[model samples]
Target: MSQFVIIGGGVIGLMTTLQLADAGHEVTVVERGECGRESSWAGGGIVSPLYPWRYSTPVSRLASWSEGAYPELAFRLLEETGIDPEYRQKGLLYLRVDDEARALEWARAVGKPLSRVGPEEIYSREPQACPGVEEALWMPTLGSIRNPRLMQALRARLEAMPSVSIVEHCEVKGLVGDRQRVSSVETSRGNLAADQVVICGGAWSARLLELAGLQLPVRPVKGQMLLFKARPGLVNRVVLMDGRYVIPRADGRVLAGSTLEEAGFDKQTDDQARESLKASACAIIPALADYEIEHHWAGLRPGSPDGVPFIGRAPGWDNLFVNAGHYRNGLVLAPASTHLLVDLLLERSPIIDPEPYALEGRVGHTA
Candidate 1:
């Protein structure tokens, strides 16, 4: 069995480690901080991208597969660790902001259920959240999971595996290898030998790959969000207006987010962003204005130029692979990305065409 060292302990890294360990490979996760505390934990947990039509075809395919896999994954995690990821099919309520025709066409092409909604229908469906809407599109099969719970369950499940282990608070400094392969990775603790290494460092992926003499176009896109404490069923489902969204949890913690700012790894949450998100949330659902702002934070999404994640072997280094640059949809794309990366590692047939996600030119591709 190959010894695999995964850099980054976010959802992507943990899920990939699970796949490797289940395949009977010795896996070790090297995390800079506490596991699952990065972009994966800070996301809204939407199982599908906000506007599926605007993304690339490769992203839609990965989201399609992940939409189906989430239910089973949640069930398995609950059964094994007694922790529910709270995978709920709350559906998506898209307000009339953009052209619905493109969305309808994309939904038809994807074989996903889409229906037009009138103002009355919108009010009837989400009276508290979406009071008045001229037009809307309802994707009833869309779902979400609580990301924090999902991460906890994943980390617990991985810790239970004898073949899987974790090393937290240890940052990877660089890599020491030759032209043929990467023999080991240099961490803050020490150098660890590895048969293969996978970089799932999310927003920090590009910097990590620089050690291998490859410069990925991946960069940090700061997203600031706000959390509100409301009563249960206040914000019934996921509500999207313009570019912002409000995700209502089972416990009534309404997550209102976010702004896509190219701030170059700035992780601070300012009052400007917080107030803007609150205004947007209140505009979408009037009741959200009354709730107290429970939390405000920011996360750096691994932004790619074309909004598709890179999941393939790195150029020049045969033993190094990358599964990063997922941007805001990493939560939705995690499962399929893991499958494709593991397939590439094992030299098996990929679930989807790897050309679109390949690191060929590094300009358009996500890797």
Candidate 2:
């Protein structure tokens, strides 16, 4: 069995460690901060991409497989760790679908149910959340998870695994060894020996890979979100209009978000963003204005070129792999991305085509 050291303890890294440890490999997760508190915890946890029919092939493939796998994964984590992920099939309500033809065609091809709902029907489901909508598109199978709880459950589950060791507050500094293989991972605490290393450092992936002389085009895209303390059933399902969305939890709390800004690692929530999000949420759900804005926060999503994540062996390195640059889809794409990485690592049949995610044409080692 290979000894694996995974840098970063975000959802992507945690999932990778879980699969490898389950396969009887010795795994150590080297985290810069507390595990499971980054983008994974801060995301809205939509199971599918914002619009599955519109994304690239690589993203859709990962999201498609993961959308099916989540229910089982949630149940398993709850049973094992006694932490509920709160995975719920609340469906998705799109107030405006620009290309109806393409959505319907893609829905038919995927064998998933997509239906048109009039203003009356839309109001019936999300009576207060949607306003002045003539028509809408509804996907009943779409689901969401309480991502913070999901993170907690995964961390708990990983801690119980005998083959897994998680080193929180330990920052990975560099890669040590020849170009043929990575002998160890240099970190803030010390160096850890490894047979193989996987970098799941999210937005910070590019910097980590830079230490190994490769240029990965992963950077931070900041997103800010707000939460409203409302009664249960205020907003039903997930509602999206324009580029923002409102996710209603089972307990009546409502969440509204976010802005995609190339802010370059800035995670501070600003008043402008908060006001903008509040206005948008109030517009979607008038009742939100009545309730108090309970909280506001921000997270950095690992942005990549063309919204496609790099998830394969690093060029010029024999033992290093990457599963970062997922942008806002990290929560939706975690299961499938990690599965594909582990499959390639084990020389097993990949869940999907691995070539699309290969790191071949991009900038290779420069430093």
- Give the Å shift of residue 364 in candidate 1: 12
The root-mean-square deviation over C-alpha atoms between each candidate and the true structure, in angstroms, is: 2.0, 1.1
TM of each candidate vs. truth:
0.97, 0.98
For all candidates, the clash counts are 1, 1
Local distance difference test, each candidate: 0.91, 0.90
Best prediction by TM-score? 2
lDDT of 1 by residue, 187-268 (tens): 9999989999999999999988888878888899999989999999887789898989999999989999999898998899
User: Judged by lDDT, which candidate is best?
Assistant: 1
What is the lDDT for 173 in model 2? 82
For candidate 1, the per-residue lDDT at 164 reads 91
Number of backbone clashes in candidate 2: 1
TM-score of 2: 0.98
What is the C-alpha lDDT profile of model 2 across 31-133, one tens digit per residue? Answer: 9898888899888888988878899878988998999999999999999999999999979998777988898889998787998989888888888855578
